[model samples]
Target: MGSTGDSGNGKAGWWCRRSSSPSSSSTASSSTPSRTFETRDPRTGDVLAHIAEADKADVDIAVKAAREAFEHGKWPRMSGYERSRVMNKLADLVEQHADELAALDGADAGKLLTLGKIIDMPAAAQMLRYYAGAADKIHGESLRVAGKYQGYTLKEPIGVVGVIIPWNFPTMMFFLKVSPALAAGCTVVVKPAEQTPLSALYYAHLAKLAGVPDGVINVVPGFGPTAGAALSSHMDVDSIAFTGSAEIGRTIMESAARSNLKNVSLELGGKSPMIVFDDADVDMAVSLSTLAVFFNKGEICVAGSRVYVQEGIYDEFVKKAVEAAKNWKVGDPFDAATNMGPQVDKVQFERVLKYIEIGKNEGATLLTGGKPTGDKGYYIEPTIFVDVKEDMTIAQEEIFGPVMSLMKFKTVEEAIEKANCTKYGLAAGIVTKNLNIANMVSRSVRAGTVWVNCYFAFDPDAPFGGFKMSGFGRDQGMVAIDKYLQVKSVITAVPDSPWY
Candidate 1:
């Protein structure tokens, strides 16, 4: 293990110590020593795993294999039921190895092992099963023809796909993309975020174990600009599904346009707001609001970062919110009692600290934790800032860390106005017992998913995506498979009566 100032977040020289086989997925070729890199633990700033770094040439290999699998292999050619058989087997394998996968996810991404083991890992396998059961159920419809032609629509796979996932939820993101694409009969080449690649690589190894055909799924772990750009611009890839910052989403659009003009679906940035009305239960609101922003150390895309409280309960809410923030245990990811962990890396750590500084300079009240807590790793205490203006940098920008911004409102109309002020429309949460307010606010929010009295309620059966600059296209549910499928209209002359 070596650290020389450069981390994987755009710098160089830091080296990770943990060893892994590139052959976990395939017979990876030997690369120049200068090209490989490593992933470090966020809690201790210690090297965790050494991954075979990929560049344009390696992306070419993965894409070529993926294209071949999509074109000639049994995967893309198989019936939905046949494909489901393999997917179900893969899910079983996931269940069998849940503990190992959870540990890898915990070590690599700084995700709580409890979260990985209990929620993310099982949800991942369940995701595979959800899509697997729906595999044979994917179908199109028939159109009534008034004239002389019999017409129907056929939904078919769009061929090879490129999936670029973020580091926050490595194992879940992998299955979220791979499951639906496979169910839709599309082979995929996945490029997991460089910060956390161990679990994704492990998944490819499991795919091999579950009897998924070679070339059906390939994983290349490298920097976004290198392997990710190569995969995005590849001419053979039919579509690309990406989840990350909005800026990168636009760049991916340009890359797709420059290449084959591939189909692109993106789930981008969010400044999701959680609004609590005076009529709401103060304790329930406080509990959910803390979990909304601080869960996963606030690394979630749909995290309710903006907290709005009604003026009637503003002081009480702040007092309770600060108390709730302190209850979050920030420590090692592997610790059984830890509820919060360090930032994913040094870059994110610096970014969160900078935001906290900006919040202070902008006149917001730093009611609770607003600084780093540890000496060895990238750890920060759960922070809360009250009296935050909507235009403040911390409130507007997507701070992908455990930082909360508090705002006050007088009326429901004002709350809705403030919540919808941001460009991001990923998700929003409202805590109120009033049925009319809940129903009205749920419909009025610009975000894709709205929780009336809950926060972060997600399921495989629900369609999730962004609405504005947060980007578009759905991730879960049967609609997710639609992004990877093309509908073709077929018409035939009725009884050969029309000659035209």
Candidate 2:
């Protein structure tokens, strides 16, 4: 395979190459790529790298390599303890190259370089090490059954997984999906979002250096309609792990069913709510709520975009929120003090601006910061809207941007009712002094993960996913490894068994 070596462009070449057979390897199609796409720096719209666009043929090659790896390579056949050592080594490599990886994500996806260094990079390493610790712990149960047969269950890797990650947190999502699948002894064909493929290709290189077999981890950088659709629908891919929009999640599910009925786990979209009760501290509520929506320019799936505040504090919260939005800095991602970065690309930038206009047309009062910043790049100011009705477009839809919608409710019942009104239920946040109110609302709300008095409190041990239109299956816990595994029941008759 044409691994991560520099071509004439001074950028890394395609991680996976087009091959005549599973074992054979060659460069891309010709001296030049049949199709090429430019990955840009979201802060300046400067060309970061010219990526070779992978098509169906390229996808086929990657899938075949992964299939061969799972079937014949040493990865799947290795003992859990042996696999754990390699995974731990990979984790060490991630930590060593944290700064470089963080820089790549900042330029490619417009992630805050500080956040990329402190939170995103470290978090990726933590997840990898967490799953590495879990690799040696994957075991099945010995069952007691009727009759003279001895029965037990064997937990085995579900071969050849296809991992399609979003662009928002490329490094984090890469480890989020790839780490557990690798720990579970399954080879993977990862299709990183087109906007941010640099770090993923680098990670593929790191995996090889960490002693993962060549075919064990393959990355194909291309658009979704071509590379993504092919990976989702490939017959040799036994399972698919995807993190993206609900609409595309549905399409992947349908393709999985129509093709080979492969196991699919999707972590999709969210129109999450942050509920603030009357007794809550206004400063704390304002701070956490802003962090929820404005972090990562609101590209996060679990962003608390729709905020429900009690009537008593609605006026005060909205007042402080406006000041906060106005003061929130939007600038170059590499700046140490920049609070938020630009949208991943022009498409998301336009989508968010269009939604802000829709919110205005629908009668929601735009309080402050609805405009874009800078003469270049896809930068948008932190926006706040008050008097947002539950039925309005901004409140109902997942406008993934630095936009917040504030609505007021009178009572706990009303808060829960209005919060649950949305079709997506990925995550929610509750801010209250009263523990009883927090418990009541947390139990009443239909979200997969609820944070009380905090927001974006993600941990490797805690499982995260969605309910309803937000999509299904959990990620980021011990349960995550199960998504890449299959349970086989083994039953054998004893020497004196009646059946025998």
Candidate 3:
């Protein structure tokens, strides 16, 4: 395992600190205890910035601000087309500052800047624009009943929402949770992960530029117990949206019930499976699986870390996967050529290492990279473990690292059984050329999203939420707005006096 360093004050020491200009200086109220979270460059361990922590009082203030904006501000009351204009302006601002946003995301979470710019930032902005276009398109339906009256339904905003984002893709998650919430005429209080909160705080400034009213989108950066728990359990908060571990998701659900039975949407953990059959295209499966686990250092919630291959082609797949894992360049996130960056922080790095050690102890063969490379930074080599059983910890648990556990299956039924063995039902992928097999496996898998030939494929127009323990409510698409609004039916009598 990697060495652990305690900063005495409960702060992670590896964070980087960057110099800030005078214009960036803003303080919370005197009553709120001011604390700082340091940001670090994962490649060099250099300080990027020290961001202020928003405590419970700060969360309260942010939520109150959002509530005030929703109830009284002009933002929620603006016409959908008018709101679309603001969203478009926000999209323009995002494009103008794409480089900056990518850089901040890279420095904060060690995501590849090239991919962050080419994929994450543009996709994020597009999500904003897509939801912005839909802002005016939210429609309610009229009921045709056997009565002398006419009835229609209205979808109205639920009120203040609290969005707690994970660290893997902080900037994207921020927009994914915030954009639609605002478009639905709901206010938001965001609590970004403490490990990577700088970019989210930076976004508060951007939201202001996008003409978002004060408190409509407020960001509070602090520990999960402090700011996150407060927001999830706050009685004034009408809904809570979270993306993180399953344990935390359950906690949030409990907190919501303890508060006001607030509407909750959770995109939680996954031990997603990727099955490659004998008839599948070997190279493409290898490529997709590599991208699935190694992208973002395999920190993604929907990472296809568990790969099951048919016995006839298992060796070929393993060899190809090992070679692909070796080619993943682990270096500074800022470098365009770098394919894999360091884990988000040291704790995460060590956690991944601990899991690798567990795999070794459980008699799983470590086929490829397992230890950290380079003298500095929190870089773990892309690890591949073969001879893994469905019962092994490596295959059952969510590692959230660049570790792939290879399991072999003899028949289609065995593969399906193993794939659906875990508590997670988030996402899964199947690689095969046979249409019958594809259709059968797709129907059998208990995941929310199943990819027939691809992995990690996402769109703003699609509804994404897990089935079982993975939690409830969708994040993107038209259904996402449903969680933020209430449905009410209005009935009026016709001019005919016979009904009276």
Candidate 4:
């Protein structure tokens, strides 16, 4: 309802100095009226700050700066060890300002402060450190050839990379894309989601402080249709690493094909299923399954929204799940005890509500929480639906909210069949003590990553991506860095060899 403070100072301390150059110190002219948008606190529907919207012109400048850095700046020319030192310094800066960074996401994105501090911010720093450790490990391989020739492969940076991150998990996604790109000696122009740009701008400031060249990393905060479009379609950009919806991923691919055919890596949407076998610990299964769908207010791309339990535990699991949903805390993100926060904004809030109505109309029984909570803010109660047919809208579409669909499966075959029914194949969780069942389901499922007894267990070492419509290209691990790199083969006939 009211302004929190200036974007540069006061309660919300996110720096917002806009400029066309790569310098973080440069500022836009506020005196002249230009296109702007209000970023709000989802917890209160209050304006956090008025952010300068970056259009196609702004995107062009950022891309040009990245290109300049990649071509002539010290960053790309620096040895891998030298680059690693700088990136590790940036990671140190992230840890030093961890709480402040956590708070920025809390106020700007309705992310729970506890989760931000413990999980989001720390993982961001860890990502930087993980990639930093791998910076020097990027190497070419000596190849054996059929002819008498010396042959090897060269692993080189893929030039300027344009990264577009989504609002959900803003800080984590920022580092997820940018860290690996930087480690590969690639200059990056990142356009953070307009809804949550505070942490990204802060990271840009940290990069400069950590001895990175000015143009090596640039942050342009703007809307998807404009700045995002420009970056995806830019001819000079060598690659585009994006994390968002499948629909938008298609648009980016189309743009890439129409442009310079830049390399594109996407981590898109999912309606992931968590299978609970009859032998599972019911209490543990309930706890993990509840967290699977409700964590991050069910905004996660790998959310286990569609859960299938064996018929032996179907009624018991349903009863416990309803109780779990009812007990899930939906309140202010700043509250230490609050596990779930509000929807990112009114649009997301309304979208979740619309799906709840759709579920009710589709004849699914609402066991608990089908309505909004609190007088203000975009809070929705944890919703659970039963009798969800496989073809039902709630079972089929990805409703990115705190909504769960509990379906019963009589056998492992049915569970696997139902799980693979969706077009999405991002991630899934299987809960079973039987090794055979776990192995069968894990192998049979079409998703990219499968958890045996856990949900949302992610590490820097594990490669993450999607298989069908969920989009392609791994996000973490050594493979992720390869996406931002190009392989060049070098061969020459041995001077003294018979072939020569």
Candidate 5:
């Protein structure tokens, strides 16, 4: 619904304009150049939207606007009930336009429309409503002390926040960061990944419709180095929240330290494992494992890319997994029957392809798909590799594509050790019938989240995050509000107070 054209004097690229450009009579020169980052449909290579690329100047403008809104705008001082009303309104607006948003997401990121509608859209709206409901519930405490007057505590917003969202689940991540920050009375400047900025931009329009004040929520769609770095290091930004790779997470932390030492919350990469025990339900193990790797074309951060099965059931598990992968429909995301879609972009597609090559070169046996399927759209068939060593690149690194590596484990301890092998500890899965094994393995595996028999099960009320190199802090649930707020303790004393 925005203008998709090259606007600047050929110096910058095309930009998506939410409104018509200012009249020529209104201003002589604009400091921020209008540039665009073209988003292509992974299934058809069609131009989805020529998005605007916000440079440092634009980043500054956005940050300043958010800062002003936080410091003086009605949103920051608005009552919790009022904020909740606005957030609920926004959620309703998103629901009203769910179909269009899902279609746009499908075109922009090649995610299945069915999944987007049933899973993503409803989940996103619920997340907004969840956070909205939490707005008025944020409270502080009072402490009683020996030598002080009566006092109480106050929880305050952390000020302007900078959020860097990932390409996968762009809309979800946007609401995850924005809704909570808004509920906590913090204005934000969001930098969406260049690969999937359209839905975010569209959400911006919906935010306006929901009565979110101008400049209260500003989205800067651009490259990470430009808009993202600017948001990360901006002096006006009081906090930074990011969802991306660990490498970039480190960079963001370093930038925060170098700038104003802003509060930072990161949800980084993962090398999650699916441990299938000998006594596990074979059918359930096989089905969940296949969904873990092939779902979302295996672009999920918690995709069970590394599968470790007990040697007793390893052979049968691999056979069933291969067969399951074969049945996955990898084609047009818009098609109602399609289950999987193309990778987000060529860079990610090639990155996954390189990992496939690495798995082969490193002597890991390729059990199924190993090459690109078609010429158009960046499509890779669901791949499964067996006989994979734990040290192989494909086994360790985050391929972020439709690739799975299998290994055999002899015992519960072995499975735990193998599952915790990678530096990432985002999530893990365990499939077993024995409650003892489940309890032992669940405690043994060091991940932020563990699924007993399911994968990618998300609830708005549940807390989600990672541990170790997977990054810190939690998202969703009441815990998410902690990162967006600062606490101040108060003390109270009896009649005679020595210190006041």
Candidate 6:
């Protein structure tokens, strides 16, 4: 099992080894019999591997390592071009081990191997490369002032970042937070979600191989409340970057305020709307709408959970959508033809099932697929509901599953009204040939991203995040650098002071 080369321990397979050499205290703590977790394949419910669950003590070790690397090591003080070289190397390695990494992702998260191998992993490496190019461009601004004193702003690294990643897209979220932090010269202690910790640890090994200094990127595989909370509230951490739910984002913000007042950036959950007008391309809408929700079994944060159709076209749209949903092949994730896969774990499986019941109890008419599929893995049918009122629980909540609640609207105004009613503002979509309607609704809707005539269109150049309860701060693009960097204004007198 020992060969994904350049890993510190050379112990590969499903097992991920710790990167840094532990202190004597850490060594003692490692042997104290902490709680552990077994990662199982969501498709088969078979044990994939086991990881040591970290607590507050383990978080302290990782945070201290990151602090030391940021404060005293050569990484933060290195030239931008030099850091860029390491980042670029990381991107290259991601491509090199794409298959192995993709398989690990499939086994750990029940992601379809085809999707992971083809889309998710490649996109992650591309995102890293995008951030790598920005490394050399991180510089202070020159001053042009009227006074005798010269003033300019310095863009410097915010030391010791704490990154908490979500399980939905493990590889992407890891680079989404870690890439820019590394580009900005900040060291990071990452606590990946308990459900999918293997890939994050594996990424740490790849970073080490790519020439990132040992302490610059540390991985502590653990749960949110213990390791995550400790990192958020630790006095040494200069900032915390998180991607998860709105409720958890609040706890992180409060922890930041009460601790060292660390900077906090969040990308939270969503109940994004996908609106279809009477004159739109119904076939195109049917296709993209299916991809939007059922692409990852609706595990995405921006999944189009609330779909609104003009009343004239509501009946027709529902018919085509259900017909398209029937073709989404759900089975073993490793199969090349499988487009849909199992939910990540038992909790999420139960949660999505509970919401299906809520839709029934709340009076939404179930059009098709309101039941679980097989008896083995946590697989559920790609469900759809029609005649859903905006006030229904299924229509309002962030049901992160392969479920779509179809609602009818009389006008564009009505569509916009019902779309923005949710507490979430992560993303929304518009499908119509009318440019006027597209521009009007795009400007009016309260979302971080609006897809016109399309759904789930994303680029590294575009800054992505949400408004209101969905959370603050942007990820990807140039704006992401602002989160990891602090601006310092320096002023120096060119002449003698007036007092003198």
- TM-scores of all predicted structures: 0.94, 0.94, 0.93, 0.94, 0.93, 0.93
**Tens digits of per-residue lDDT for model 5, 314-414:** 88988888888888878889899987999999898899999899899999989899888877998999999988888889988999999999889997887
Query: How many pairs of residues collide in model 2?
Result: 0
Return the candidate ranking by lDDT, descending: 2, 4, 1, 6, 5, 3
Report the lDDT tens digits of candidate 4 across residue range 95-133.
999899999999888999988888988899899999999
Q: Positional deviation of 148 in candidate 3, in angstroms?
A: 3.4
Model 4: number of backbone collisions: 1
lDDT of each: 0.86, 0.88, 0.83, 0.87, 0.84, 0.84
Where is model 5 more than 4 Å wrong at Cα? Answer: 1-32, 490-500
Off by over 4 Å in 1: 1-17, 20-34, 496-500
Q: Candidate 5: deviation at residue 316, Å?
A: 1.2
Candidate 2 lDDT tens digits, 360-433 = 99998999988999999999999999878888999999999999999999999999999999999999999998
Candidate 6: tens digits of C-alpha lDDT, residues 1-500? 11122233211112333332233121222222256777777887877666777778767767666776777888999888899999889999998998989888888898988878778888999998898899989878888766677878999999989999899999999999998999999998888888888788778768878888757887777778888899899999999999999899999999999998999999999999999999988999999899888888899999998989898888899999999888777888899988888999989999999999999998998877878888799898899998788888998889899999988899889889998999999999999999999999999999999999887778889999999898999998999999999999998887864532
Error of 2 at 150 (Å): 0.6
> lDDT of candidate 3 vs native?
0.83
Counted clashes in each candidate structure = 0, 0, 12, 1, 2, 0
Candidate 5: residue pairs that collide: 13-36, 14-36
What's the CA RMSD of model 3 in angstroms? Answer: 5.7
Candidate 4 wrong stretches, greater than 4 Å: 1-33, 498-500
What residue runs in model 3 are displaced by over 4 Å at the alpha carbon? 1-33, 495-500
Q: Give candidate 5's error at residue 373 in angstroms.
A: 1.0
What TM-score quantifies how close candidate 4 is to the native fold?
0.94
